[model samples]
Target chain A: MRDAVRVWVLPAGAGPDELARYRAVLDPAERARAARLAADGLRDRFTVAHGALRVPGGRATGASPAALTWRRGRYGKPALTGPWRGLHTSLSYSGDLVAVALSEGRPVGVDIQHVVPGGDPVSASARFFHPREARHVAAGCDQAVRARRFVRLWARKEAAVKAAGGRLWPNLGMPVDRADVVECADPAGRHRLADVVAPQGCAVAVALAGQEPYAVECRTDLGDFR
Target chain B: MLEHDVPTRDQVVERLTVLLTRMLRPDAPVTEQTQLMDELGLSSSLGLELLLALEDELEIQIDVEELDEDRMATLADLADYITANSTAR
Candidate 1:
């Protein structure tokens, strides 16, 4: 049987009083990382993202949000350390959204980007994206359309690389197929990538192994947890 | 590839040193033995950005996989790789 992938989205910003409640769930190391950030907004985002990670992560592992610990890989990919076996996870945040992806039996990564206008999508694509992706983004009829396309492609690659535990630098030149569903090669194996339909103004994606028709269960109403 | 000559080791080193200093660490010592990640705290995105700059400056295309941990360990290693891969000046 194929494993299912779950994506949870939480609001990125929080008031100071609420931020403290979320901050309570993080370990000392996470708290330290949050504290080290120079900007209060960035600090709040880090606290909430890390804290939100615990909710789905704990649910999948049957551990409390505060009880979960993380061990980073050689490439610095964070993984659950203790008894939460068999669950793979990834997280990403952009602008107003923090997304967490969880899967069983396969590694997973999620990426979401808020598409801002006036940024040179074609030029940005040429610099950072694979030649094929650059061409694809440029093929869009207009600037706004192209920018949106570029973000989708960018999110796909980011999510795939995160899932593969691969470096983004090398994979920047790695070509992904034009189809919505594509596969990216990693040292370990190939990972399946998919474009996620996200809320307006954002592009989201999830990457994992296997070809099964996995369902994406998304929840935006995570206010109670915070 | 014929349009531009492969830069010499010293040339590559000099250019890389300047690039790293400007983009990654300013007013810091950059040597062949300097670790990109451990010493400079460069993230994967930044590492890729560096690679892209090198490609642009050198007029060469380097596969991202080629810049694995071993190849990107230090400044000299990348210089050697770039010199070997680039068209001979």
Candidate 2:
């Protein structure tokens, strides 16, 4: 499973020691970006996310965690460029968790959404999601369940578009709540999407472009991430 | 739902904030100067949903064909585009 999609997630609410340890791996630019965020919570989340990114990027590219630099791609997503371009990567965040995914050569995309406590999922799904996905959201037993279903479907849709390097507005209507393999009617490309195990109150999805089968390996432990 | 009335920029931002708060339930206050895509982390799909809701509530038609995400840096920027491009359907 060497080429399996590698995913790592870390809880954003970490102690000072752990947070600083992760912060050390970030470059000056990333640290500056983090500092520019006004809220401490947001700053911490950004730190953890970039740190987690560097750890896997290091392992994937065989470079020091601090040595890797991500350049903005066509869609403005931070992607590995130059020497590290060979390793495809994507990152996402929710309320209190962040995730990073890496693939050897295939275009990969990952998204995470939190099922936060109060929102108009019924109206939201109806307004935003495809008719098929809206129906799926409506099928949930209650508001919380509906919100969970809604966000999971959204994660899949976002992951698909992210992998395609396509704008999401044009593809939000694509019904992807039914299958692991996202079969959009468009014949332009195909993506394999799966719901990865996420922390409580979060929904995570990973998408990779290709027809060949691949494993989705998730690393749950972050104790020795460095 | 004023179908024929042209909404002012302030009106548009007011309606946008109402819809956004209802959908996202964001903890932070959403001001007109707020970065819709950056600070709020509004996904493009959700942003479209917000736009559609604005169209419905404001009773205006938006030509999204030429919309550029790069120029839509803040709520005010989006409102400017709507005010300039929108017409009664």
Candidate 3:
């Protein structure tokens, strides 16, 4: 009950000047990561995400936005380092939204996904998700609801994996629909997951690493990108 | 589905490239070395769609039990595994 995760939702859409401002704060490594993306849209989102994600991390650690340093964990999860090493953070970008969750000591992972209209989630769930999860997804009344459930379950799994800094493939079959807080063995930890409020058509979930209850503080700061 | 001869590795690679291009609509050419998840932004669900599509396109069955980061990182890596593991469906 003592843990608290502060999450910030930022708009991923940026104009040329806005993109330049975000890129200006990025370190050389972040710039290189963004450059490797081929598509302009993908590259722009990456730039904005990495730059904007640092805001909450800096604020939590009392460091300047430009002073936060990030390095990839063994599994490619972005981790705070240097002066901000004590603060834990994770980020996810979906469509036009980027969500970042930060906590003082508990490693946090946040996922925001834009559910595609008319995409088939049943087959995807059957093929990839846990048996119980697949059944839960299929239980949805219609395709629309099924897709929403599919992405929600997916966000939970991904957020959990990100919290443990574990790989996603092996944990795909982890049954998350059973309860909000599930015991997972692959990560060897308890994942407390909650669905955060998001824009319509977007599914958002945040995972905190522990069995104890925690509070999620959500902040919307679209103005940061502008 | 009709049974057919197992496609050679090169044939698999060629068709896989076409499939990747059509599916991804990528900015650059989808090469054998292209990173599927990173460059293409392939989600786990989309990744399944791809494997299913590949099975239908090639008329083969891929033993997905072996599918992991080691084999799914790039087009070439996937093609190699598919060539070895697939059977006429």
Candidate 4:
């Protein structure tokens, strides 16, 4: 009956050496998963450095980070296996920051972006953005205008799709612009989509399914792991 | 799908400007051409929030298709679209 979403913000400042040190602490299973992620060009050092902090924040009770096994679907999205059932989680990295969100009984997705002035949000939108979203970005006259709106919309859509447990392909037929709040009715049931604004310079969002009051807990500290 | 009477061009612009000012950070100065994201730092979710707010305040339904990038690039564009399309009921 507790439906609160817990969000943990991990400092991104950990360097390569620091990440390696963290990796040494991981149990065999987590180390293997970290290796797989690294094989995919997801830096092991960064993932370990950040993932180490996020894994514990879940407060998975008797669970340990290294004991958790991860499985992925065709889209390369990762999920924890074994004892970690019914709990949804997501991870995002931006610069020196790694963010993770946890929700029980609902899929969760999170994204963070550092706003850089005069970035080409329009071009980025066109490549990965939906037609409607692309058109929306195109409306902006300058890079700065387009980029800001582009990233915001991008993060929202990505988080929604991620929460739904698959890429947004055939489902794109649905008009995203019409719904202020969207619910993804997967075979597993309904998932709620919501957005959260991180401290300025950062944008974040969460998707939760089921009938539960939405609550978010965010922290900028990673000192708990040390 | 909007049900309220169409607002005047100036009225729409004024109202939208006020909303933008409030939603965006105090330091961010929104202009007629200010892009919702770049200038105002609004994400897509916030954009939807703005859209919903406008719909609620204006008592009109804004078709998602109508709110394309070109029409939503500036406050002037959004205001114009609202004024031109709002119902006259």
lDDT of all predictions, in order shown? Answer: 0.73, 0.78, 0.80, 0.59
Q: What is the TM-score of chain A alone in each candidate?
A: 0.91, 0.91, 0.92, 0.73
- How much does candidate 3 score in TM-score? 0.87
Q: Write the per-residue lDDT of candidate 2 for residues A34-85, one digit (tens) a residue.
A: 7756567777888888888888788778898899987775555667877998
Question: Chain A of candidate 2 scores what in TM-score?
Answer: 0.91
User: RMSD in angstroms, all models?
Assistant: 5.1, 3.4, 3.0, 14.8
Clashing pairs in 1: A170-B64, B6-B89
iRMSD in angstroms, per model: 6.0, 4.0, 2.8, 14.0
On DockQ, the leading prediction is: 3
> lDDT tens digits, residues A1-226, model 4?
5567777666655666767656655666555545543122244434554465445533564565545566775554567676676776787665455677776666677776656664556544554456787788889887766766665665666566677665443233333444536654332334555567576666666666553557777766545544
Q: What is candidate 2's CAPRI-style docking category based on DockQ?
A: acceptable
**Number of the predicted model whose lDDT against the real structure is largest:** 3
For model 3, the stretches where C-alpha displacement exceeds 4 angstroms are A222-226, B1-8, B55-73, B80-89
Q: Residues B3-67, candidate 4, lDDT per residue (tens digit)?
A: 35666677667778887887654354666776653344354445555765676576665544344
Question: Can you give the DockQ of every candidate in the order shown?
Answer: 0.15, 0.26, 0.41, 0.02
Q: Which stretches of candidate 4 lie over 4 Å from their true place?
A: A15-21, A25-45, A48-50, A116-119, A123-132, A140-142, A168-180, A183-190, A210-213, B1-89
lDDT of 2 by residue, B6-80 (tens): 788888889988987887666688888877655665655466667878888988776654455664778888888
- Give candidate 1 misplaced runs (Cα > 4 Å): B1-89
